[model samples]
Target chain A: MSKNYSDLNLIVRSLLPENQETPISFLPEDHLQTDLFFRRNHFTYPSLTNSSYWLPIVGAVHTPILFSFKDLVQMPSHTVKVVLECAGNKRNLFKPKVFGEQWEKGALSMGRWKGVSLKTLLNVTGLKHDATEVVAEGYDYGNRTDIDHTFSYMRSLPIEKALHPDTIIAYAYNDKPIPFKHGFPLRLIVPQWYAMASVKWIKQIRIINKKFHGPFQSIDYVYYPQKESDAGAYPVTYNRVNSIIQQPLNREVLDTGLHIIKGIAWTGKGTISKVELSVDHGETWIRAVIDRPYNANYEWINWSYEWEISKKGEYTLMAKATDSFNRTQPPEAMWNRKGYGYNAIDTVVIKIE
Target chain B: MSKNYSDLNLIVRSLLPENQETPISFLPEDHLQTDLFFRRNHFTYPSLTNSSYWLPIVGAVHTPILFSFKDLVQMPSHTVKVVLECAGNKRNLFKPKVFGEQWEKGALSMGRWKGVSLKTLLNVTGLKHDATEVVAEGYDYGNRTDIDHTFSYMRSLPIEKALHPDTIIAYAYNDKPIPFKHGFPLRLIVPQWYAMASVKWIKQIRIINKKFHGPFQSIDYVYYPQKESDAGAYPVTYNRVNSIIQQPLNREVLDTGLHIIKGIAWTGKGTISKVELSVDHGETWIRAVIDRPYNANYEWINWSYEWEISKKGEYTLMAKATDSFNRTQPPEAMWNRKGYGYNAIDTVVIKIE
Candidate 1:
């Protein structure tokens, strides 16, 4: 781990295929610095690369384009401080247990990603009319228990999401070259979706005509609603409206006094309209004040409840976020066999002595 | 609704099939009186009958026997106070969502059950050596979305569980005949398991030579561990360790002062050794004082935390029951595709004004 990356107290979830979680409560920051961000890898790290690394855009396009890191940076740049949360970030919290990486709540991070807009690249590459999806393949490759043969970490986005201005071929993190641990030369940043759609280690891209059914799209990362059949299952896309209490970590002992309960809330559908905190178990909700400036699509909004307590005892804290779409988190998380999109009301118990 | 049952403030989950839940918080007694007990029915009420109802024990027995209510009452009497919770009591709280009744957390109540031990009846019938399971069929029959043919509510118990002394064919609630709304003539009380195994309004039972695969046994009460397939799934059996705070309703606001945090806790495999209260997200657990007088198997133990709060704001109250088997309630309910046995840590948010 780089000195810059390891010092942030990022908890290492796994080793072979590196997976690290940001100690979200430890970093008291609005947005993560590139070095303080979390890292998730599906396979062994790929060979490091410099800015001259070439990215090939192939298949179904009128003309394929080979853009080196230098060439991409030469184009007009766009920067977005977007939040990327792994679809399985809260898998461990689901009942009955779900398969794959057992992330708690921090396989998520926000960064000022600077890159060439994917639409700009698609325009330059001149995709054919039949193109339906943009597939990005990473340099890391390995075999998983779900599949037999070795395969690269790959994901695809629908034509519209791919062309959205917020979608970019990210090459810089916080105005600096992307860290080697986080897809060195270039990465595809598909905002408003789970980080899986933000394919890293950009080796090549494919403009495909069909709904891509690669392992990542067809078999894995698919949300199976019920247990017995796959008939109504769909690809795991878009982050559900979610929020978490970062202040006063669960079970933290506090004294009777004024305390600030703070956390972050986000959604893929629309801007977070408001966040509500419940010191009482969901009976009456007190609207939390959102730090309004960062209410953008694909970005998380910071929220805080200034709790001035006169009673010294145990308190349960529950946080729920509502999106501009008027959707509020449910008391219970939606049940999916795979444990994806868990947006239940976030709860924590605190003791005041 | 019977004045006896309705006066207790039962919430109607449905009308035609007659599913009613006890407003558990409203009752202060250790065990429910016959009039205050909850009622869960899967079909229209069967023809109500007075004593003289005949229960037939047939199949895989030396001699099938039919016993009348008088005959049952004449047998050596046994009385046990047991708690019966619907397997889907907390189904509404499961993630990804589940099917069947959208029950919250109140489809459970305890009562003084009086009846002849099922073993006593089976002993008279003399189960054949090949008997593998005992299938109980309720008189009520209905068509459901998953089944084409109208079928009687049926479930089975393995030979071992069927012969357990605690398993009784109850005909009396409290000291009187079972209420017509509950089961009337006969209700199988499979103590320690989800109420589903306690088939109500029982008409007959069959000692089967092989595993029972009735709709209720095979399709409904079975636990599907994952959404993909039913490979390692098993029948919903014993109730897992669970607890819930009752005194302070979720989000109930109160003044800062000395307050009692009261709740009930139970488990199937063993005694609820202790119920711990967590006010801090889960950082520190304080053992609760359980009323030892009723810590019987299949029975719930009432517990209380004497919390005196000096400062007020919001408090999250969490109750976790730990059984003598060394198992403690999990923070997350186990994942079951069908949403069975949800025993996650019970959390309630209370506000201290």
Candidate 2:
């Protein structure tokens, strides 16, 4: 049975229900439940058959290659633990609140993905010198108010991001076949960018001589700064620094005494350098102990701080993260028309009795 | 009519309302309106008589002196514009929401004060070599739950801060007699610390032989870091870095066009080195234009950023300030039980339609 997209009541809906949010508190575990991984689809699931399928490669190439699923897996396969977050995560917190799924930091999840490296596939197909962009298109089609006609979900990446060794065309998740709701037989995973860049139900790869101007590429997912014309807007790329408080949820009443505060921090640009906590409404901050043994370049790090509370009153708990590149989460998330990349400091209020 | 203390539903009310908030947007001006200046009192306003009144100078002094107001103004009065902010400003933003007035950035103001330097008064009284702290007492009296017995509002400062040239006993505000509500006749002004350190309606000054242990000084306004017991909390001092966006208040809707975003930035530690704006949800940031001619070592500097909006959508505007000492506003304010010294980056969201 097909699900009605209207039933989801998502903040942003073009093709499929923007469902799937990971229960982040269960993290620090080696593998996330396959059902709990975030799923962002641009179209309804396409019907599948036992017949073999091929991925077509066209444009700016000396010779285009149409490789079957068997052909991709025959080449050396690589496995990686990657975390994916919707660009619009935490969009509900924006003042005046932007449009899209009003996600409150749950639109993210981690998975152990098994895939064939894009670089390996690129090495097999000879590319022309002028090929500057790699356009990836999905088979799903949908109507978008931002564009004129029904179009398939498609996006393009620069040659550098496309050729990155970590970029992959995946066939399995958590050592199992990719779930039908998540993309079925195949999907593209661009580890660093927002989940939107990792096209789902991917069908064709086209190498272009110049920047691609698809609606999703040019008009949508672009950064329109205040007063700047849309023509000059920059395309959204890497994720910013962000952190979340997992223990003692907001407004949780507790006894006036010592308590342990904990949370997780992550960023797409670099490793988290430090995490800090503020228990007295941002009057003074102290460093939190980050669990370093399980830290990974792409996975979130767990951190904790012990706080002693003798006074019975309300307290606002806050967490901030700084990346190795000296980039820190902003006190407030930057605002974009599409609500992309909202990574402000995380806050939660609780009462002590 | 005397107002009963119970009538005031204040977050931090004991002997007095503990109420005072500067109208921040009217700042950077040469003189703030007398009515708009923040007024924090620890007790009911004490009626003043024209008959000879003296400010008693006692404790660790070779010769105790009772100098009248006339004697203070006679010592070459100096006038300066200094900004005073309640240390607990923006305390409401902390997660768990700590106690004290849930101030949202309006507990500060600038005033042109006419007074005699504390150093001049100290020189006349002849401080003993053992004198290490100067405790200032206000005439207003009240009961206390934090301590035993009815105590006058009193706070002590280290000799260094007490003897600083900027520290003064002010006789007038804005070239006029100080209003009754705002410490009429005379008040102590400690230029750099939070308003609580500046005792209001002053009547006595006592130089101590050692560190003072008054309720307000050693207990109330102290910093208690995560691991520290209440007994080990540090006394609150010097204000932290802070900024505010006065124009285009949060959630303001405007037409899609060019608009100038303006605000004020100030720090007690040093001059503002830079101010940056992020309109793309902090994915990228650019330097804002700081109004330079009005810049003063002790006053806030006005800043403006030109934003051109061509897209009709929601946007979150953020501002981050850095000081000459390399201290930047944290992504989240530090938290203290008293909710003091919140200096997180300022953020606002608006819709362009």
Candidate 3:
């Protein structure tokens, strides 16, 4: 407990890239990506596995070839804004029905993703005609079976999405190089999509002329439509519109004077068009003032509102958002079979004097 | 590098609370306050030294006594949500002229501050009627003769504000308890005020009838009002009405479709009454929907909007907020002598197809 701060820093530096320094001070209280909980379980594969990752291209539009680390560094680099959300996010809301990590909305973040376009990387290697799916593999230990299995982390995407110029085999973050825990060396960035597609510690990429199948791609990380139909299930693709209340959670409070309410919102397929706030349990709606332009496609937008209270009282507050396409944040929590994508309307209660 | 997930978990169990048994996966991200920068140069004074911290209470108050943790916790308990912000946040906005820590907005955070009321805490020991100023001391390394050479951290408040029921000697955070990195078992939490007043690693709480003097008490953490005389200086107190662009700093481009913009807004004194958004770079104003109640006095509120782009073009977006008292976010950053309390309007650029 009395360890030197420098010694702890040395341990962090030994495990991560020295070039990707964030002053350790930038990590906010709500920001937990650097907490020991997440860091403790990271890098086990890269630190212990003997097998290095490889980038292989075998698809319809690109040349088929196996690329090495030297080959990856040789590709042209491109940068884009992307937000990554863990598939198990908001799992705490599911309770008895859900089975996964109990992550509170902290499993997401926005960063300037930097790397070579996966499309370009594929084009460098020859592609087989008629390919439709692109598969990515990781070094995370997976048991191949459930009981004693290692965490299997792999997923595939349609060639169309994979071939997009913005989609990249990410190598850097915030303009600087990335730390290994954040998928150093190489990883994939599928903007506006779940993080499962952005495989970490990537070791291989395969393009298939036939449909690619995997547990993560099929049974897991998939978004089942609200109406489960006989037409077969649609895979979880683009992210849905969502927002989270950053204030008045459990430990924060407002002063007994004029104040403002604030939070973040975003969508995968469209832009956020409107965010409605209510103080009386969504009984009435007031338009909040938007603070910034819709800057990133995948990144959440910041927002706020002005309110006055002359006396002391207790009240419940709620916020719900809608996208440009007229899709509003669901008032009720949606029922996802896997309890994923819980972008329901968030609520908070406060007492003021 | 190839460590087992289970093995890594074991390490965590040893460092964090083991008796609480809050399931390995049920941990909340922001609950832990440990961070590398805060851990640096941690004070481990076994006995009194030159770098000693003091907590003085003055003003229309009673029960005035300078007591250590051994006495502070002996009083009753009270809990409230309080956010502490370093006066130097966003200082890089005015580089060179300022000589202080270059902290982003991350230095601020909300916590469930728990401790005895400064009033109650003082009453238990004793009080010298007629005190008006409550000064605090910190163990920052500095020269005793040179006021500027005082500790790197410190702040003071009016006695009334110091003894407000909402304010307390915080010893617990987010429930459970406080770690050494976050003021350990005792510290001050002056709701709605900046974090400087919430000195960490508290040592003594003294109650006196005269105004206290210290380098941190008079010279540092002072902010001058724009309308007030620049020659005169006043200690910075109440927080201002402000909001931040939490996402889409570099607007993302999605395939022609609906989109949503989101962000957070907050005020120091009361609930926010209105948040006005301008998509045309402040040229036009539109009301956004607020997501929560305006009652919380210290936490942030989430707000957002949606915009549809049928044609491709370049656009500028801006967000401005007004509080209950008609206090609005400034369109431009203010010219602060010390570059503190930056609540200027936030803007961003976006391209749509």
TM-score of each: 0.50, 0.50, 0.50
- Cα displacement (angstroms), candidate 2, residue A199, comes to 52
lDDT (tens digit, per residue) of candidate 1 on B72-133: 99999888888889998887678766545556678888888899999999999998999999
What CAPRI grade goes to candidate 3?
incorrect
Candidate 3: misplaced stretches above 4 Å? A1-44, A48-54, A59-63, A95-97, A144-152, A223-233, A250-252, B1-353
Cα distance off (Å), candidate 2, residue B276: 1.7
Instruction: Give the per-residue lDDT digits (tens) of candidate 2, residues B242-286.
Output: 889865656555666689888888888678889998886666888
Model 1 chain A scores worst on lDDT over the 10 consecutive residues at: A1-10
Write the number of the candidate with greater DockQ, choosing between 1 and 3: 3
lDDT of all predictions: 0.80, 0.74, 0.60
DockQ of each: 0.01, 0.01, 0.02
Better of 1 and 3 by lDDT: 1
Query: Where does model 2 exceed 4 Å of error?
Result: A1-353, B1-20, B23-31, B293-295
User: Candidate 2, chain A: TM-score?
Assistant: 0.91
Q: How many clashing pairs per prediction, in order?
A: 33, 31, 90
- The alpha-carbon RMSD values of the candidates against the true structure, listed in the order shown, are 25.6, 19.8, 19.2
TM-score of chain B of 1: 0.94
> How would the docking of model 1 be graded?
incorrect
Q: Chain B, TM-score, each prediction?
A: 0.94, 0.90, 0.76
